[model samples]
Target: MAQEGKLDLLLKTVEENKKRRVEAKERARVDFVGLKVVVEGRLPQVEKKVSDLGKVLGVLSTKVEQLESTVSRQARAELLPEDIREEHLDASPSLSTPLIRGSV
Candidate 1:
């Protein structure tokens, strides 16, 4: 009778442990699903922010390109008159600039 009672108590303990494990596993699963839903809910705003940032970067890139081209054209316009005059003086056979035969 003592052995039978001990066996019943052991079986009851094992059944309780199994039920507790099942409940804990279900709780963990529910928590994981809730976290995933929360993260998914915020994803659209993140995507929108990324898209808006891309558009802003594109506009800035375009503005930089236009500014670069304008500055390049301005620099060339400023330097061209002197360059043309030098070319004319060097190409002429006149006595405007003396030529030294020893300096390459």
Candidate 2:
């Protein structure tokens, strides 16, 4: 009878452990599925943000090119004599004008 009781106790402990393991697995599955859904939902927004950033970078690049061109022209003007600078500007009216938009 004592042997039978011990067997029963061991069986009960085994069943309890099995139940706990199953519960833990189910919780992990639920958490993983929820995280996947959240990440998928945010993917489009993240893509849009990346696209907008590309546009901003393009605009900044164009602005930087314009600034570099202006600085180069100024540096050239400073290097040349005043009479030559005036003659060059008079000969090329377009060089005195600002760059047109979307020309980048």
Candidate 3:
């Protein structure tokens, strides 16, 4: 009789453990589904943010290109006058006397 009672108690304990395990699995599944839903809901917002940032970067790149072009034109303009003056001087040979040979 004692052995039969012990066997019944062991079976009960086993059953309780199985029930707890099943409950734990169900809770984990529910939590995982909730997490997935939350992440899915936020995905579009994240994508929009990324897209906005890309647009901002593109605008900045265009601005930089424009600035570089302006700078390039300004630099050429600054140096061009000097080059023209030198050319003009070279073209006018009669303005300066030519150096004679063997005369320092």
Tell me, by TM-score, which candidate is best: 2
Each candidate's number of clashing pairs is: 0, 0, 0
- State residue 22's C-alpha deviation in candidate 3, in Å: 0.8
Model 3 stretches astray by more than 4 angstroms = 65-104
Off by over 4 Å in 2: 1-11, 81-104
Candidate 2 lDDT, tens digit per residue, 34-79?
9999999999999999999999999999999999999999977777
TM-score of each predicted structure versus truth:
0.55, 0.62, 0.56
Candidate 3, residues 7-93, lDDT tens digits: the string is 999999999999999999999999999999999999999999999999999999999999999999887788777797897888886
Candidate 1 achieves a global lDDT of 0.92
Candidate 3: residue 18 lDDT (0-100): 100
**In candidate 2, where is summed lDDT lowest over 10 consecutive residues?**
95-104
Tell me the tens digit of each residue's lDDT in model 1 across 1-104.
99999999999999999999999999999999999999999999999999999999999999999999999989777877779789788888874344454444
Query: What would you estimate as the lDDT of candidate 2?
Result: 0.91
